[model samples]
Target chain A: MSGQTSAAVAAAAKSVHQDEEELHGLLVPDATDLPLFPLSAVESNFVAYFAPDFTKPSHDHYIYRHPNGLCVVGLAPGHAALRDEGGVKGVDFNVGKSDRSAIKVTGKRKKNAQHFEANTMLCKVSTSVDTYVIRCCVKGSLLEVNEKLVKQPGLLNTAADREGFIAIIMPKPADWLKVKSKFLSREEYSNLRVESL
Target chain B: MVAGSEAEEDLRAFREAVSLVPWHVAKDLISREVCLHCIIRLFGIREPAKGFTSLSPSMFSDIVAELPSTGEGLNGIELGENKDKNDDETNEERHPAPSICSVCFGILQICKVNDAEIPFEKNGVNFLANVIADAVKEEGHEFDSFCVEVSTPPAIPENDLSLLSYINSKYGSESWLQKKPLGNIISLKEALKALVTGPLETKLGVNCSQGTFRIWLTYKEASPLTSCDDKTPVAKRQKTDCNNKNTLVACTTYGLVAENEATEPCVDSGKITMTIPTDGFGNGIAYHESSCLSKSREPCSLSIECYRDAVYFGGRYLKYSRNVSQTCWMIDEERMGVTSVEEIISGCILPFCRGDKSKFHAAGREDIDVRMLGSGRPFLVEIQNARHVPSIMDIKGIEEKINESKSKLVRVKHLKLLGSEAWSLMREGEAEKQKQYAAVVWISRPLEDRDLCTLSSFKDLSIMQKTPIRVLHRRSPLEREKIIHWMKIERISGSSQYFVLHLCTQAGTYIKEFVHGDLGRTNPSIGSILGCRAEILQLDVTDVKMDLF
Candidate 1:
């Protein structure tokens, strides 16, 4: 439920960095850098839209990118599950590090290793309006994270999709092609922002 | 009068009252005190009794005090005169403290139910429990255990006119079950459960409301279904009228909830569900006003009805006739002589099994025009109330019975008893198994044998397909990938343009779409493979590779 355009974030940025270039603030909207694809099925209540980075970093690991959008993750008291390595802040993880997380494949469940439909909550995202949980829409191996965004969170506001990548997801060849097909390209997303306004 | 005979007399009087009065007027005449006593008797919670289920005594008394009441007046209700028929204004009397007893009894014998020593204020829970405990001996099932299930009459909720008022005054879009049902109506299930559990366990030699052999005690006080009710619209209710009296005793453990109109026929056969696998035995008792007030006899009519639990059996069916379908196929509610694979088999075996209803579950189904030929398609049939079988059934005899269909519509083999686990295996096999089909293909031009040589090389090749047009209305339009394992030309015996193809495909491959190409909705179809147009004239399941026994 939490959502805002780069322009809106820039306006809100009027308070954060008044002296910074206003044109740069509005022109590079990181929040808009989300990956989403609609499934080719009836929109039964069962269907979920996935919007996160999914790039293969190397031969073995995949990446799940955060939308160039910065979500205010809660680090409230008594909540110990979401501890950042350095107590960095909010939902952001360790900065300046890009590493592939190893995944274990066992049991008969690995047959559909490329697909993810069963859901699990990874973290909570709080926007100015509301809070929404960032969930794994389907099941698959999560291979890597773009630690670069943690150190340079501005990439989300500036270069959202390409440089503002979040984490990597490992899906088989067929599923990868399908997930990639649903994402809106840079030009299309720009047009969408203009039309939405 | 003997106490046992008196309870029977009270039952006779109750039946008389039901026959004599309209249920709505009767609804007013039967007081909460009577309901409280009757519920206690039926559940047998206050005292342990043979044949009857029991709950704790104290809880029963506590619940009675909290039961929604017309509040205090017990003398106002008059059944025979029907004097208070101020129809429109009477609706406002949502809570009528029915103090008068016109029926549910014939002659007051002053039985233990009306003992002077038992305080009327505390209710006759203790005394009445003792009397019911003596009136009958316990019935037994050969099964190891027993359980209790309560089914309240639909008419119980009909009395809750105040519920609408409460909703309008309260918040929007909240479910009533979240709060009190229909305003202060104590749950019959809870009341019965609290009253019967402990007492029943000590007496029945089996756990009450705990095990698999469940006995459904349905208390139906709704007005009898008329010829008109058949055409009338009912939202969600499984209406079965085996006996005129509303009470039924069923031994079915099937989940009983009537679905809405939008529901898909739960079985693949696509027929509306009307009954469970077994029929419930119904016993009805009526009461007269004076017979009800008489304490010697409890008002109940006992026409003993017995029901047996459903049994499971399975077999592989071969549909030789292409004119038949796996299930009934009709358009605009009209049917031809075409019998479905389910109908032929259910018709043959249901008679021997003597079940009220039979459900059909198969590995998969073929189109109405297609035929199932090879070893046959595996299926599981659950016959409700199959009394004869748990005693060594003759599988070959059943196979012969199924093959006796006049039209030779279908044939069944490997008929055997199946367990619950087979249902899931049938489902899994349908979704994930490989299938081989023989199709009669007609091409636009004569095709040489060499032209189809590329078919032998295809293996685990994936192709994209969109939902075909014929099924577009039923299925969503979506792009899905299916695999084609291999294709072979089994025979080129037909005309120059006609031939046969033996194809092995993934579980969900659209063979017709693959052959005809559905205007390129299916890529690399037989049409695409050969540089010519191809369509299937007839198709048959050569084999379904589900080795599940």
Candidate 2:
């Protein structure tokens, strides 16, 4: 093979290997499912927000998901890219700054930055069709905006891929305000939205 | 008329045939006086013309004063004046009063006629009465056949010795023989004969037949006899003053008084009265009402008098140290040196002492040699006839006196004053009573521990024992059963063992021989059990118990 074609093939093989490895990880039960909260999350001001009309409180809910339905969500620190109407860089996301790009998660999630880094993966993500994993991050006032979902990126577009892709993806919310209120504080519900696709 | 005269003649013939004897003799023989009088009154009457022909001479005299005056009188009547003067002088000289005889007819006459001597003074009337009563018994005479008579002595002048001399000259002498004339004088002879054969034969310090007699003539003025008139009527006599009289009759004049009062200030006043031993030695005068004497037929005056004599003679110092054996030892002519238990009590100085016989009881007996220690064995010594009875202070003295008097072969201890009932228990029971014993034995060889073990097994075992040969002379040959209560042994010197064997057995068991086995007479004995020949070294009695009052 030529060098460029060999490099592309080698990268694709590495990515497939990584996916296969993550798929194995998703099949096993996680420590969080066994009722073990991480010591770092308990120390920080990591609050789980509930929707305003949620039947049960947020702490009672044992399962959490990413907006892309790619991974189970757990406490992590990260920055989310904020864009104006036209997809443009607005501000750098940090833990304490209050800017348009800075998102404030209310309730117990607001204080998570002191003890935990902004972007960290706490649990594995598994699904019926495809397995995706996500890590949460902390912005100044926003939490879901900074999350990253990793999915099986490229494969031949087969029937199994489409079905697996739909099975693994988190359903998108009809009302972003309600979703935000469910993930963050009610006071910040108007300013932010949470979507899982 | 001729027939009537003929009938009278026949009656005279029949009267003379019936009247024969003198009136006095006939009166004395027959008891019925009226029958004699009726015979005389009917036969002595004569018809008026034939008076002399019909009556007998004695009968005719008796009825002569009763006949009516007859026309034909006798011509031999003496002149009245001359007869009257002679009768008057004779009447003045002789007092012709008739008195009943003092002597009863049933009693054999002991006095002679015209014998002035009294019957009692020569031989005590009451004493002779007893003797005569005994003699009558010996002769087999019935009790009512003889009557007793007490004769009164003729009055004797106090100052006139001449009257006594005159009487002595007239009579023979004042003797028992002279007083009773009915039989031969045999009292002295009989008394002497009895003295040889009687209880006096064993009495010491007394001659069998020794009595003194003396004869003297003296005049004695007698008291006048009291008169009892037939016609005067019978009345109870009042107490009379006899103080002025020279002589007073005891029973009659004194009229039954107490002896002390009767003989007050007499010679017997100062002496104590001796009482008789009725229930044996230490027993006092058994009262008439006493149950012991209740069965006696007659009142026991002899017992009473004997008690009086014993009390009177014993005086103040009574010795009660000796055992009260009922009988005394007798040897040949004397009662030996041993005095009777009664005599010992009687001779005791104390007037009122009492005691029972001495009994020897031992817890275990010794062979006459071993002495008892530990308060000299618990024994009871019953003191008898204790005059001057020891007070608490005198008990020690009395005990010392007894110990001093006896030989060391026998020792008396635990001296006590016991009642009469205690004596009865000792005398009445069997001698073979249970006793405990301790004996020291000398073995032919020393005993081993095995032998001692064998001896210990003999405890609580019963053994049969034959009489010991040494005491066979006094005891019957018989087998006796004795129980061994317990035993303990101690080793003494070589070949000698001191064995204290306690046995509850009949009282008279020979403890010494029992230990040694009496040459095998006592089977299963200490010697036999140990399988060794043993001999008694010493035996001692440690305790004696008798249930007594």
Candidate 3:
């Protein structure tokens, strides 16, 4: 909401000190801890990638920066998708807005079955520039996930309970958030409907 | 001054008294005393002196003149008169006797007795003295000097007591005589008689007479008197004398007796006879000549002589085995255990009839686990020592006998009666010969194709190896060169593989280790070439070529 430069915003996000104004900018209230589950632990095809420049379609994608070098990057699937035709068709059409909205509503119904929970509002956002660069500095513990997630694809179906989500190859962090928020909001809305009293 | 003059005149009278004796007599007495003094100085005798001052001058001169002078012409009349009275009587009967010796008395006699029958020619005196000296020395006496003196018949040879007493007393001090006490007086008489008779007449030679026979019976063989086939006749010449007709016969008889006494029975042909059996089996009886049935006490060196004889059995006649070992296993039952070699030869009746024994010589031995497969190991067996003799025409029979004796475990082919040189060559040629073998190796893991290819390349490669650890305890540690003549993989089974390896090596090369390679103790081993642990399961000797020079 404030007209802050990208550098200022990055600096403010990185600052360890929690000021009232910065806290208000974060979406989830009264939560400082982030919950995380490994991407591999999820059964559903919910995996995402953050591509800084969609037109160039290069694999060099950065998720976050920390004092200790680059902390997250896109894992190149490379020719893995090409070798399996079923993998492409299953996730290709779902990226459209209408299709995204419909999946969000379905995701909301499935939210109760997911396991992980998170408070942080730092999501990877896409930009209008030819190269989309998303910058968010979060606490080191906010991104940690149990290592078993890498080995089992079923574990990734759980909700990520963490302060941040990182998608290095995807553009439009806000749009991604809207889709995720809609899923969560609808799940909450549906639970209210079920409990009339 | 008057008393001094009287003392000087007394001194002059005493000097005159000492000088009245003849100068030579005084000189002789002085020289005798000087000689005694010299002896005393050399040997350090510590006897005290006695006074001779009271003797009259003539008496003193006579006593002094009695001392012997070294000169030939200076004869002392008193010394001549002192000779024992028996000497004067003998001086008339025979040619005048030499003055009697004071030490030996007249016991030592020198008489030349000629006997024509025996073929001995020697001077009597020198021989007698040598015999006496040898006898005395053998008795271990310490006498510094000795001389022989003879008395003629008029003198009672035994009665001259002074010299006899001296000899008797000296004999008492001799160590050998003291240990075994001889009848001193009787020994003196007998010794004198022996000196007169020589060794042939007396069983005890001059040694018994001179009291010098220290060691009796110096040899194991019988006495020469028992050995002689002819007996000498004795004749009584007089009441006091017996005569031997031939002194040469006497001497020769004694010499033969001495020879019999000195020669060892085992080595002496006259005492023992050895007859080695000519049967194919080296077994025979040794007998003493005296009794045909009695076994000889002497151990004899064996010399085996072989003869060929034909054998007939089972409707087929066969030549007896040739060059078999001297005796059958039954004969060697007392010596070594039954070797597989013997069992193989004796298994069949044909072989048993063809040869009594199997003589085996090998370039080297293999572990019992190994089988000699190719061309059989180069071996030679001398069969003629056994009792079964094969004729020259029975070569086919001999061949059949050897083949029939063969067992599944062992077989002898190409059997031949090799020359004596062949045995020598088998023994001596081991250092230069080479052998080939095939071994089955069990590896710890399966061999990759690359490893197999690498192993095959090892053919014809030479390797230097220290003796394998498995045989280290029995063998001396040594480095040997073994050339891989050829190697091929016969088959592969899981982790086990079979290899046929040809090694051109010295006869005794450890073939099994060459295949499995003993923990890299052998260089360029099969295990190392294949880069896996390997061990031998079974081994067979394929070929052995040994050349006889």
Give candidate 1's whole-model lDDT: 0.45
Identify the runs in model 3 with alpha carbons over 4 angstroms from their true place. A1-197, B1-339, B346-358, B384-388, B405-407, B449-452, B492-506, B547-549
Per-residue lDDT of candidate 3, residues A32-118 (tens digit): 221122112111112322332222333222232222221232212221221233222211112212221122211212221212122
Residue B250 lDDT in candidate 1: 19
DockQ-derived CAPRI band for the predicted complex in model 2: incorrect
Best by lDDT: 1
Ranking by TM-score: 1, 3, 2
The candidate maximizing TM-score is 1
Model 2: residues with Cα > 4 Å off, grouped in runs: A1-197, B1-304, B308-367, B370-396, B403-411, B427-432, B493-505
Taken over the whole model, the C-alpha lDDT of each candidate is 0.45, 0.30, 0.34
Cα RMSD, each candidate: 28.1, 56.8, 41.8
Quote the positional error of residue B335 for candidate 1 in Å: 1.9
* Fraction of true A-B contacts recovered by candidate 2: 0.00
Instruction: TM-score winner between 2 and 3, please give it.
Output: 3
Evaluated on CA atoms against the true complex, candidate 2 attains a DockQ of 0.00
